[model samples]
Target: MQGAWFAFILTLLAGLSTGIGSLIAFFARRTNKTLLAVSLGFSAGVMIYISLVDMLAEARLDLLGQYGQPGEWLALGAFFAGIGLTALVDLLVPEVENPHHAWRVEEMESAAEAARARKLLRTGMVTAMVLALHNFPEGIATFVAGLMEPATGVAIAMAIAIHNIPEGISVSVPIFYATGSRRKALLYSCLSGLCEPLGAAAGYVFLLRFVSPGIFGVVFAMVAGTMIFIAFDELLPAAHEHGEHHHAIGGLIGGMAVMAVGLALVR
Candidate 1:
């Protein structure tokens, strides 16, 4: 029970990282491209390492124990399925609008709104909703992984949290700029993270009943795939776009290396 509570908290913390970014947006006044690049790179490394070394391997082992050779194939399929599913979600969501080129937040403006400001506020709220849906399942994955293994869960949580910082920026920048309300924009960003704890709660109420080693393994594999896709498809590209950093590839390698060490230490 204590472990479960801890896992839930970790998942919540991971999801709420967007709030951190949102806060940064409100005060920082500039993008800090180098910081964003390095953080994103580091996040990618952490995710890749955990996915390959820890999650995927555990998944394969579980599949082997259950269906033997077929289990391995099943795990692989599930892995890709997770990636495809997330990509599909991204494709379906409508894009948010940002007038300012700056990716980070600058300062808060008064909440007075014209017609255009209202539209921007609506966009920000909608984007936050979309992000909440996306984050829900991720929260579940993080919580479950943590419940099963605290160390592994911590690594995953950190990776997810780091990745989420940029997402916070993505959410807050437009709304703040449009409506000139730091509080409103930051609220939307923070709300997006709530999905994680919601996901965890749902899993606890329903899926925990049927929990087994095999189930855990398959889920882990899927989570691994999900994280990898997120890292490659989103984090790496965003990092590069945010900063003209020379160490883009280096950041990737560094992320992977850090994750590997993290996994090793946990084991």
Candidate 2:
């Protein structure tokens, strides 16, 4: 029960970071692209390390116990299925309006807003909706993984929180520009984040009842795959794009090293 509550709080905090990003976008005079880049890179490293070393390792072991000979293939299949699920969601959103793009402060300040108000409004609303949907499965994956293992859950939670900050900016920048209401923009950003905890709560309530060793193993494997995809497909690229040559790489190594220590201490 305590662990469950802890997990929920972790997810909640991660979701709310959208608001933090919104706040940064609205209030901060200067954009710290380099810091954001390093953080994203670090998050990717943490997620990748935990997915492969901890989550997937445990998943494969449980799967093997569940189906001694066939477990390997099943685990592998589930992993890919997770990736496919996330990719499908990505495909559904139009490339021009993908909500995941990190918006820069300079760009926001310099844009010709009066001319583009109508377009920005449409883009903002669509992006918010798409981001909300995208976060649902992530919420489920995070909640379940945490319940399965608290240490790994903490790692995942931290990584997700870091990853979502730019997303918050993505959702808020256009909306604020379109509506000219800081309050409204902040509200939308927060609401989008709320979907994560809501999804987590629903996932836990509905799925916990039916969980078995095999089910747990498969879900964990899927979560691992999803994390890996997010790391490579989203986090790393964004990080590198905004980063100085070595900053993102340095952050990545630091994140992995920190996770290694945590894994060692936990074991």
Candidate 3:
């Protein structure tokens, strides 16, 4: 019960970190492009390294123990299935309104044009909806990982939280500018973030009766696939868009190194 509670709390905290981004959007004078770039890159690195080194490996081991050599194929299939699911979600959302499309805090300055306000509001609402969809799988990933290993859960939650900061900015900026209401912007941002915990709760309810080694193996592999897709497709590109290539690369390497050290110590 304690472990379950811990995992739920971690998921809740990760989801709510979007509110931090909302607050930053309101207070920061300018988008710190370089910092954003590096941070996003760092998050990508952490996710990629952990997904491959830890989650995938663990999943393979679990599956192999259960099904012998055929388990290798199963693990691979589950991993790709995770990617396919995320890709399907992406295809459903129009590219223009995809929350993964990075938004800068500086956009707030120009968003006051009355002609564009309605469009911006629609964009914000769409982005929020899209982000909620993206966060659902993440909530499942985080919750399952936390249930399996608290340390890994903490790392995954932190990575997801870091990336979500920008998502909060993405949803809030356009809405705040469109509605001229901080409260509305914050409310929408919080609502979008709430999906993470909602997802966790939903996954828990559905999977509780069937929890088993095979289930863990499948979920871990899927989680690895999902995180890898996010890192490569979203985080890396967004980081490059900030125009700090070297810094982004440095942050990536730094993030991997930090995760490596942390894992070594924990093990």
* Cα lDDT tens digits for candidate 1, 1-267: 899999999999998888887887667756677877887788888877778878888889888999899999989988898788878866666553321112454322222233376666676677677778778778877887888778889988998898777678767866887867788788889888889899889867755788775887778888888888878887787778877666666777887887667666666
Superior candidate under lDDT, 2 versus 3: 3
| Top-scoring candidate (lDDT) | 3
Q: Point to the candidate with the largest TM-score.
A: 3
Q: List the candidates' TM-scores in order.
A: 0.87, 0.94, 0.95
lDDT of 3 at 121: 90
* Predicted structure 2: lDDT: 0.83
Q: What would the per-residue lDDT of candidate 2 be over residues 182-253, giving only the tens digit for each residue?
A: 998899988888888887898788667887669989989998998888888888888888878588888788
Clashes of each: 4, 0, 0
Each model's lDDT: 0.77, 0.83, 0.87
True-structure lDDT of candidate 1: 0.77
Please give the lDDT score for candidate 3. 0.87
CA error at residue 93 for candidate 1, angstroms: 1.0
Regions of candidate 2 where Cα sits further than 4 Å from its true position: 112-114
Model 3 residue 202 distance off true place after TM-score fit, in angstroms: 1.8
Stretches > 4 Å off in candidate 3: 114-116
Worst 10 residues of 3 by lDDT: 106-115
